[model samples]
Target chain A: MPMHSPTDTPLFGSWPRAYAVVLGALLLEIAFFYGLMHWFA
Target chain B: MSSLDWWILGGTIALLVLYGLYKSRGKQSFDDYTLAGQSLPWYHVGMSVMATQASAITFLSAPGQGFSDGMRFVQFYFGLPLAMVVLSITFVPIFHRLRVYTAYEFLENRFDGRVRSLTAGLFLLQRALSTGVSIYAPSIILSTILGWNIYWTNLIMGGIVLFYSVSGGTKAISYTHLTQMLIVTVAMFIAGFLTVHKLPTDMGFTDALRVAGKAGRLNLIDTTFDVKSRYNLWSGLIGGFFLQLSYFGTDQSQVGRYLTGETIKQSRIGLLMNGLLKVPMQFLILLVGVLVFVFYQFHESPVFFNKQEVERLNAGPLAGEFQVLNRQHQGLSAQRRAAVLNLQRATAQNNDAAAAAAGDQLDKADEALAKTHAAVSDLVKRNNPAADKNDVNYVFLRFILDYLPHGLIGLLIAMIFISSMGSIAAAYSSLASTTVVDIYRRVWPGSTHNEVVVSRWSTIGWGIFCVVVAQFTNRIGSSLIETVNILGSLFYGVILGIFCVAFYVRSIGGRATFWAAVVAEAVVFVCYYFDLMAFLWFNVVGCLLVVALAWLFTTLQLNLRPVRVADE
Candidate 1:
């Protein structure tokens, strides 16, 4: 995917990518916690 | 407290307050006072937003939550990232474009004054009451650790912030929040490290986790579909989403935080930063609590974490009975320590059977200890009918005081106090702006009252109001953070529903949406009053109820309108 619009770049290169990073981070954290839960369970 | 600790506490607070006042100097108008002239960069907006949400209750009670309830409570913020995304895509852009001081201002254009006024009113009521609770959370720290009167602590806590908030407005709040979050991050990370360090020599971090996991404190993700379960993943993701969306998207305390952003992109980035950081931050805080749980498994734990209450009960007529319970608590603590040691050894040896046996013994010992604590609590209640039965709020405070080094203890207290000030300042400013922009200015457009003067008075009025509310907060029986959230859940959903109607259901007029919100709010309250379901789900129920009722009422109106028009 295009990382940024050349004329109007913002944080994380673009708005969509920025949002994707946040949502992606949430997924990663949830996965880590889930693994911890089961590993310890 | 030691002299070194006192110096650290006093110096840190004084420095932070002076820094805020310095950074916010020379704000000229009500706009500058309320929105920091909307000139802050994304990082300032981000830190300010985080600080506003994380009140004293967060630092004081979240770890206590982790200590008692386990890692599951971290799930409650699962929906927050999703809420942030929605807000970024929709709410931020519109609020920025409209150039409204309060989020409710948009409602007037979208619907009418009544819808806007009602939403603003709901925000004011919830924010003020919760600000009182926020004040009470730090007051607990002072009253418990310093052995000061609760009333005096409440006043000091409320008044110190009031002075800055009234004078500096959003500019002061933003700078203070930046400092506050920095202190919180550094203090909590150090505390987490110290908690693990305080554990027995043989226990590695993984060993501690294994012991905690065996004790069921690591139940971080419950994928259960049960509606009544409070901290399960499903509710956290769905219900928590609505609650958070309403909170950040519509609640002026939060809206005011981001509205300080220099531009739309800045605001969105700030919120996105919060989304990315909050869950992990909360997880670490709770993990510290769990580690403290691990720490106590090795050392002797407090029967009741509120030392002041325990000392008070000790001096009472039932001192003999309390001593007997104390002896039982010591016995149970010894048994628990032994079982935990065995469990730790078994886990180290990788012997599953021995570990399971030790875990059972540990559970049994801990259960008996919990019962003994309950009996002592009952005695406390009998001695003073108004005593706070829940010690969850004091668990972390007691740990910091009893265990941490002197200077560090002061830093931690200062951290919690600063956090309380940040949120209270934000709430005070938000309340003032909503009062001025939504209620006063709109109500009396031609009045000669200076907006800045009225705004200052409004800030002071809210400060006094919240302080009064703080006086009654001792009767609240739950963990402080949960109490604040539960109070918020009562109104947030219906308010979010109104916004959803305004944003989505274009056919639904203002009157239908307004009345629907009122009726839906009543139903949500009824649900809450009866303990109908887990409080998180009330967010989902209330939001959906308003949407459905508004749509239904709109349909009825359409069906009846033509005949009335023809008659006319």
Candidate 2:
């Protein structure tokens, strides 16, 4: 396997993209949990 | 009753041992032994990380937690995924780029040698003791179910893990973890299905949920911010976040898992996958417990879950009082079961008035049952002073043995043993690595000769140390899960503080941070001893204290630095 250089930027470079991915994940978690609580409550 | 279970158990052990030895074949180098030559792909890293976290306690106790306290424990992992994201962004890339063997190694380069050694020492102490408890946790279940001596069970459990860990090292541990996790996931899912299946034919999965909810076992969230409450949403998100961060980012055992990733991206992805999956995984496990609780409601449960202790109580002077409690327990259990069935029926028919009436009756019956349980536990303690009086830990285990078929029973029991081995093996490997790399090499400078030999001996020594710790673990109550967390909270904050200073605080050199850590740790100990707050909050308090104290000492050092330089 080829190792990425330490200085090489990852594919998801922009700060906005990073923030969007994190935010989307958080929202997904909340929605999934909400559904679980609803169904199992 | 059948030969299948013995064959399955023997075959599982044989396959695991041979696979471990096969994967372990490599050069006799310390790095290869400790890190699998740092060549594992993302899947191996992911499975290894999950297996290490999902100890036997998780399978054995989590459902019991759900049965006793409800699903609120699932909240504890809410912060885990977020912690993984933070670590991926900050900790992962840095550790990968630096190419450090242990997380503490980075502390030395960023700060000073003392800081590195201090953090490593804390990891050794906490992980070693926690691993022993992990070994002891499953041994209790196995010993209880199979009627074997607990002491021998501990030795066998610890010895099995040590065999593969010593022989094959990290590669063997990871490969076994991958297989172990696959088996565990399937077994646990089957266990959950069986728990619901054992309920009355009319009581479907939804009905079980209604009964569980009515009994308050489906409690998944609490918005309350009370520091004393252990598993509320506030603590799970905030306090759990800090704990998970310190654990994955700073703790060497977990760091060692990701460090083996062939590339930084693989490590990050593996960690991120854990963060995403952990909460749901915990929720599913806890949900199984809720189902077990429902199963007991419709069926007869023991007056006391731990049969041995109950048996001793029956044979002792407390026999009369225990008999009365047992009768009361049976009456209350019958009433509660009827109420639970009625509530399920009412809910299904959408009869609000009937459901409400059944719910009230169920609550009253549950209160009587709880009192009976307490009385029985008191009798057990009065009879045998050494008895683990908490029956909550034994709830799910009792259900498994009494209800599940013989073959499945053996597999689930073996699953617990396998889970224990995966974690104990990883911990043993990590303990050895830190001792060899951080303390031994540092103290005996220029002793590169026989480094692999030294590492092997260190693994053996730490394995024996952990087994010894396991021997005395029974004296510490049945709250193995809580005990491990409390122990970690005692030291993680100070360790995290040292790393935080190393990373962000440029002015705070080794001496100031070291002394600050000592002081912060003392304060944390005092807080715990005095019972100022819940144990989970200790993680937050300890980490903040280190950061605050380190800044204070750094300012003092800076002021003295100018005067001392002028004098010189």
Each model's TM-score for chain A is: 0.73, 0.65
Error of 2 at B252 (Å): 1.2
For model 2, what is the alpha-carbon lDDT of residue B12? Answer: 78
Off by over 4 Å in 1: A1-8, B558-568
**Cα lDDT for residue B554, model 2?**
69
Candidate 2 lDDT by residue in tens digits, B1-568: 2477667766777778888888887665777887778889888998899999899999888888888888888878877877888787778888888888889887777666777788898899999999989989888886786777788989988888888788877888898999999999999999999887888888788778778777888777777789998888788888888888899988878999999998877787788678767877888999998898888887788998887787778787888888888888888999998898788778889899999899999989998888888877777777877777787778878887888888887788778878788888888888888888899878998885687777778888988999999998877876678888888888887887787776666666677777788889999899999999988888888888988887887676644121111111
| DockQ comparisons of all candidates to the true complex | 0.45, 0.27
Give each candidate's interface RMSD in Å.
Answer: 4.6, 4.7
Please name the candidate that would achieve the greatest lDDT relative to the true structure. 1
CAPRI rating of model 1: acceptable
